[model samples]
Target: MAAIPKSTGMQGGAMAEEAADELTLLAERHLVQPWPMSGSIGAEARGRIEGGEGIYVTDAAGRRLIDGPAGMWCVNAGHRRRELAEVMAAQAMELSYNSPWYTTNAPAALLSGRLAGHAPDGLDHVFYTTGGSSAVETALRFMQFANNVKGRGEKKLIVSRQGAYHGSTYLSASLNGRPRDQDWMDGAGEQVVKLTCPNPFRRPEGVAAVAFCDYLVAEFKDVIETVGAERIGAFVAEPVMASGGVIVPPDGYLRRIRELCRQNDILFIADEVVTAFGRLGHVFASQEVFGLDPDMITFAKGVTSGYFPLGGVMIAGRLLEELRRSNHSEAMFAHGLTYSSHPVGCAVALKNLDLLEDGLLEHARSISGHFQSSLKALEELPLVGEVRGMGLMACVECVADRVSNNPLTLDLEVGKRIDNHCQELGLLVRPLINMCVMSPPLTISTSQIDDMAAILRRGIELTMDDLVREGLWRG
Candidate 1:
């Protein structure tokens, strides 16, 4: 493995200079950034990626790595599509900014209309935002406003699931069940109640499939009752768990949850930040995979394939009508940002969606079966306890004891070792609490898929060999 260096490492002269300037600017702004790379890796890393095309990112070091994680699970349309760039450039030249409330722009209106055709029925009204977190906040606030408009002013509590991640804004962050993210907040826990993640692999002993569903329903019902069903606002969940180890729920889980929410008169908010577009072999994972018809659906990332920052909440007809009736300029829901529905972002998103509809959506669905089958091969490795996920999103969970099914906690180090080895082998993956996750660009070809599988297999094999050498494995 090539040793990562310390300080500004040398590469191409021009690229190094550009990287140095970027590093200096970052230091000046005190943008040390969250999710920093490990020290040796961070300090010596090339500070800039000059260009990207298709499924590859070319860093200042002139090194190219296949973007296995789709640039943080956003670039589904792949990188550097000239058509999207052209649309953005043209939109910027024409109308760079316009408020959606008063003067509307072509891109925003047209894109919203296009989105309406693709989203689940009744979810035709669109409210745009700058990114995923804002979209979640929009949904949260919209729920409150809708409840008040409908004469149920007391509904304020929200139900979320453990191991689910929404975003970084206050309400969205609160909805996230990761302990580390919740460590600093108090009001979030007070307002947001979390239920156990419906992970069959981690459920307690004697937890039958039917019983598990009942327990989940019971938990939500108890919370709604405690909060007062009329006062409980909405239940938010990711259709396919993304940040929390890519947990794909057992069958009937989502259907049961949707039914429970319906029975209790609680609005269901589908946080599809990671699963929307083509990531889950669906335009919307809620409809395509779970048959869930949510009152509000939030999305970002793949909408523009990470080309530009854009996200929004699609409101159901019932909510939209209520909002429209309650409109008084002074008393209307006035939550909005200056950059809300920025024309350039919308233009890029519009073009990107066109490309997705033209091919990527069907492309993802066609190849997902093969991808899952190839990924399951990792289950043969001794250290691997499980292989599970849907569409292009997947995870390989490591374990200390396979028969007992004891999950290997982060401190076990196997996950990090395997991840690092894979990076050395020219693959990039992020290890969740106890598993390594993969979400490649939908534009990647079969050859690239095979390459990804080979790289990951090598990492799994190496990890198992390391475990045996350390006397941690008997096989």
Candidate 2:
């Protein structure tokens, strides 16, 4: 990977001039920003953030914008954490990197133990990775290892839901079900199965929540019968699907799916890359919020609060015991990342966790009511088809015809327009096609949330005005 360019954090004349030109030059020569590389090269890179403090970031031009999506849903502790920065520097100076293969580092071991203590009782072991993608890839590979060692080589298919964004790695991305995630990209199609997303808004229009959940469960049962349970290895899902526009599953859906996995002898992998680490007001949302006891739980993002690239999987004690008891003797799960168990990353994560547990978790919980209520009020907009979320993660979806769920001419670019307006109105928005998703820093205050919501309302109103002038929307 290219070295990360250090921010100058300048807002003045000469410094700003250098920063602006450097931003474009960096975009021109290097830095393929994810998802937007589809456009022309050096296409005016927007929002060159120079610095961040609390819930707001200062652009190169010194405009402070409310960080609406918490730096791609990672900066749970918010940005510019002095303590976390100090930890990174101190650990780097003491012990930079030790291979996870042969040598064990103190920071990594301590982080593993600390994380285990935070997780459920049986998830006692930890495997570190560079980010959420690698963490998921590690878990999926572990499942494959387990199935093969047990003499069930045919049980290799992974089941994932539509509209779920697992990761960007080849194997992890294969499990992604979001729109455009796999359009021109190749995935391990033969090894994966896709399922319908349990999104209430996208479910059959009038289907009740309970009935919708039952239907989802029945679909899984039917699929298993068709494929023969022995051929399926593990079922992976996000408790509340992030990046698929924060598509929260129906009530009773997650637990029911967990039950199905148990009955079918399939390992359930909970992908909590977003919900974990106080995003949902908890260290982990698996058993606490969803009542799920997954066979494996993969986490990243909030773990290091976006300070360092770090992620890991919590291994269930039962899975290890099962491997130990399997007949394939001396089998080895030979997989390790160069950055796995990285000392500096681990040390930063430990301090990040301290900040989270200190007061941010409870603060997230306290502010959730205001966060949800403020955004939910946007449902009154003519263009807003629905507004849904839990905790700090939420989405505002727009539609030309709410009944049909049609984007009309707006299609995907609707999100871009609202984003532009929001940026101008002193807030940054994570635009998902026609949907605006927000997962601000857990440290965000109620007043900041109100500010975010107000900017969002104005942004939507601006979009409405544009559509009316264009003669596209009746509003």
TM-scores for the candidates: 0.89, 0.95
lDDT accuracy of residue 369 in candidate 1: 84
Model 2 lDDT tens row, 115-194: 98888779999999999999999999999999889889999899999998999999999999987778889989889988
Q: Could you tell me the lDDT of residue 64 within candidate 1?
A: 76
Best by TM-score: 2
Q: Estimate, for each residue in 1-475, the C-alpha lDDT of model 1 and write its tens digit.
A: 2222344666778766765676655544444545554453334432456678898887655667678788889999888899988988898899988876677788888988998888988999888998899999999998887776666777888888888888888778888886466665554777887888878788768888668777777777777677788777888988878888888887787888888789888888999989998998777888877888998899999999998999999999886666667644245676988888788998998888888889888899888988888889889876678899899999888775555455345324777877777877867767775588889999887788888889988987887787778877665
Best by lDDT: 2
Q: Which residue segments of model 2 deviate by more than 4 Å?
A: 1-15, 37-44, 205-209, 401-409
